[model samples]
Target: MGRVGVDGEQRLLLRRAEELVERAERSGRAVSRHFYTPAEQELIAGAFRGRTPLTLEFDGGYEGAERRMLLLYEQGEIRPEPPLTAVAIEFPARAAVPAHRDYLGSLMGLNLKRETIGDILACPQSPGIVFAADAVCGVLYEELREIGRTPVTARPARLEEIVVPEPDGILKRATVASLRLDSVAAEGFGLSRTRMAALIAAGGLQLNFRPCESPSREVGEGDVFSVRGRGRVVLTHVGGNSKKGRTFVELTCFLR
Candidate 1:
């Protein structure tokens, strides 16, 4: 849920969580609140029959579409249509977005960096904003321009297709180029680096199922790296140089 990847451990944990949920239900602890009482149900039926506004019910954990419906209900009858910004597409990858069509809706371009993205998203919707998922960030700028929008960049340059996930929980991931190991950890997880050496350590963290355990390991550009608690990070290359002639790196932070 934090970083994104395919992990058998995650599946096992989810399965266990489901088992616990079933046990809780058997104990009469889990209840659905979307159901209405008799009077409310009758009122809802009348509203549906007469085309009146129905007081809809929803569970306590409503989100996305459900959350929107509840808020609209609380705001009273539809009356005149409320203002809505045109749909937007956002490019949030460290890589530049490729060119593509909305094929769906209007496209708006807002200049923003990979950082401070949340602030741009919080503004009221406008015709020029297409809030895209992370998947769209590697599209070509010229391709995007032909479709009537341009890619915003931190620096002026033409980048290539990274073929990376949006990191938003929907897309399946492939390989990442590189990863970062904390210099100050003083140890691997809790074990000493030397002591942790020569162990299988197969799936603890990997790009495409290759063992990458050394504290000095280089994750490479475009690698999908996962740590147990740190979540998943994509090793996106920006630009870099040698520090005292030792290779230093620049990477983009893709939160999962």
Candidate 2:
């Protein structure tokens, strides 16, 4: 693995990379690792591809989580533990229920970074809110006292223990003159075409959670755009063109 100019964290990642390689070679079995950011995941993947023939596995707690863990395994030789565990928070029904902000605040207030936690499922219909975190889950269950000013109770939970809600976002339909990345993003996000293009050129946005600066890149259905100051727009559908020849697109905008 590349080690030049590596920091402590990068060195740790490389060590884990080495371990994954060593374990596979020693036992002829799959090995797993945790706490990798998306960027880190890619870095490790690139590193592994250069050194071995083993396969890489990636999964966050949920579909759209920004941070996830990586599992390295050999063909037909892997059985890994679920990298994350859920915790349920119970509060008085009448009390004000805190949203992601509060839950996140409470976690970070304890010196936990956002990467240590995963998707937060909070909905009005759900009796309790649940969040995913690393397997070392006792801290959240034991230390979190309240969400903002409202007191609450939290306990360990399985995925089946709670009902997950649709991710937080607003869905809308729009028509764009072209399927070019900039055009669809501008229409879906309610921004002027020039502004969208300008933002992209200025490196102020990301496509599919990865940094992207090209405005003319085509945006198909299910593509996600994360703009720095504005928000995120997910292209949900691409229908046939209108009589005027504009493409009809469905999008879901998730505010940051």
Candidate 3:
């Protein structure tokens, strides 16, 4: 709990862990609820068939610890996820992914790519994935910000940290590291386009946070594209990759 780990002594482990939680609460850092009771300790070792070794999470956000606790339900005690899996990224400036909750849970099932960690997150209701290494994640974050988007967190940002705007708020916008969007919006905003004309005629759509006459407009990073009676969006560059051997752009957008 406090850098000091327990060995074979169960009593010593519980004592130190309780102290750590107390310290965390006082310091305003994330805290861990009560876990690892002395009586339950022996049960865990015995149920796994003669004292199986247990591993604590580097961070207590993962439910791997809880899965172990569930063993307790059958024998020792089944608990919720451990702290290690809770936070996927820890870096302060990184870009997030538009993954679903099941995606995170799938990460637990599948082995992570080297230097990466994956986990599920709820509340904001999305999959949570973060890099384990700071340097790599930091690089990704800087690129996103440079392109005028929010940086993702270091293996600690939860899915709730980012989200897609609701249908009511989806406006055309681009993140950093993305290409031009003038042509893309032209049809949607031009007077000839019946849909665009109707929406614009209603005077409810805004591009780059400005109420433009039409949808055929230039949009880039830091642009707040909005549709009246619809929703707004903030674009975050998510870097580039090859899809079918072709260059592809990725970005995260917040709707509504």
For candidate 1, the TM-score is: 0.23
Q: Provide the global lDDT of candidate 2 against the true structure.
A: 0.73
**lDDT of each structure?**
0.31, 0.73, 0.36
Residue 152 Cα positional deviation in candidate 2, in Å, after optimal superposition: 2.1
TM-score of every candidate = 0.23, 0.76, 0.22
C-alpha RMSD in Å of predicted model 1 compared with the true structure: 20.0
Q: Considering every candidate listed, which one attains the maximal lDDT? A: 2
Residue-level lDDT of model 1, residues 57-141, one tens digit each, is 3221112221110111322434222121122333444423333333221123333232111101221111123222233333422
* Arranged by TM-score, best first: 2, 1, 3
lDDT of 3 by residue, 8-84 (tens): 55445445444543453354332233333223333333333332222222322332321221111122323323323
Compared with the true structure, what per-residue lDDT tens digits does model 2 show for residues 1-256? 4566556887787787778778866776544434566557666776777577666666665666555666666777755644576677777888887887877788788787666676667655334555455553677778888888878778876566667666678888888999998898898678899998998888888887656788999878778888766778889999999999999889998875
How many collisions between residues are there in candidate 2?
Answer: 0
**Which segments of model 2 are wrong by more than 4 Å?**
1-52, 62-66, 125-135, 168-171, 239-248
Q: Is candidate 1 or candidate 2 better by TM-score?
A: 2
* Candidate 3 ranges beyond 4 A from true positions: 1-202, 238-252
lDDT measured at residue 74 in model 3 versus the true structure, 0 to 100? 22
